[model samples]
Target: MTKIKICGITRLSDALESCRAGADALGFNFSSLSPRAITPERAKEIIEKLPPFVASTGIFVDQSPEEINAICRFCKLQIAQLHSEQYSPEDARAITEAKVIKVFRPEENFAVEEVFAFAEKSGINAFLFDAYRPDMAGGTGETIRASLATRIFNALGDSCYPILAGGLNESNIGEAIRSLQPYGVDTASGVECEPGIKDPVKIKAFIQAVRKTVF
Candidate 1:
């Protein structure tokens, strides 16, 4: 099954709603640059109320390994999603707690070998593919071609889970899943009334759509 991850959660209400709506994972952006960014204390509050089996992911960009690990500990996160290309594999492996998921922001010039190179990183549990924007790391609402996503999947070939994100909503999610066959799909702006705010109706529809889809 293609797991559902609702990203850019800013409120406990949004977090609980997405979880109640059947999201497999929830992303809490700790990156200062993100509009949807949340403090470790705030993320912890929401995480504590969450039911078991639902993963809470901490999104970090360009932070030191120690800082990331510390925040993960503080929040009791189950996953750490490293979003910076500047973050070395060594940095990823240094994380002691939560499993690491390194993101790949691929542009038109992106290469499959780049995916292989990042895959060589130790301690990474999965890889998430997102659209690359020159001005930002992710959550740009631009999507990578599923063909590109598919190519990377073929290369990785179950060595690790491949997750797809970027511009995904209820309308296009089915086609995106059908094409990439990713282990998961993440959405932030796609299911929101605006950045940092989620629409409950969209959230339910999105999850229902993912439920209806099959690889």
Candidate 2:
């Protein structure tokens, strides 16, 4: 079954709602530029409130490995989602104990071979494909072609788990899942009433839509 991840969580209530809604993972944005950004202290407060088995992820962009590691440890995050162009194999090697999901910005002339090679060398657990938006790293609410992502995933084979993200919502999630059949689907603005705050009704609807497609 395709897993569900509700990204850009900022409130304790929203986090708990996501867990109650049957989310496999919850993403906390630690990137400074994002409106949804949360401090390690705040993230820890929310993480501590969570029950066992729900994975917490810290989202980083152009942040030093030391900073990422420190926050992850403090917040008890199980995974790090690196959404930066500056991430290197050395950085990945240093965070060997952590599960890293590296984000790739799709280009007009995107080369799947080059991306697959980098994923292999970086030793990341998964690859997230997002539409390239200059103003924001992600949470752009712009949909990309699922077939394009599927082709890349097909080329990369089973070793690289593909996550289809960018502009996924309750209405189109089923179509996206049916076409790509990604390991998981990630959403932020699509399920949110505002930048950082999530709407529970929308959240429930989104999860329901995903479940309908997968089950």
* Root-mean-square deviation per candidate: 1.2, 1.4
TM-scores, in order shown? 0.96, 0.95
User: What tens digits encode model 1's per-residue C-alpha lDDT throughout 1-215?
Assistant: 88999999899999989988999999999988899989999999999999898999999996898998899899999899989888788888898888999898976667777666666857565889898887987789888877776677777777788899989999999988887788999999989998999999999999999999987
- The sequence of per-residue lDDT tens digits that candidate 2 reaches over residues 113-176 is 7776777787665888887888899999997766667677677767677888999999999988
| Model 1 lDDT, full chain set | 0.88
Shift in Å, residue 24, candidate 1: 0.7
TM-score leader: 1
TM-score of 1: 0.96
Query: Poorest 10 consecutive residues of model 2 by lDDT?
Result: 89-98
Candidate No. with top lDDT: 1
Q: Candidate 1 — which residues are off by over 4 angstroms?
A: none
Backbone clash numbers for all candidates listed? 0, 0
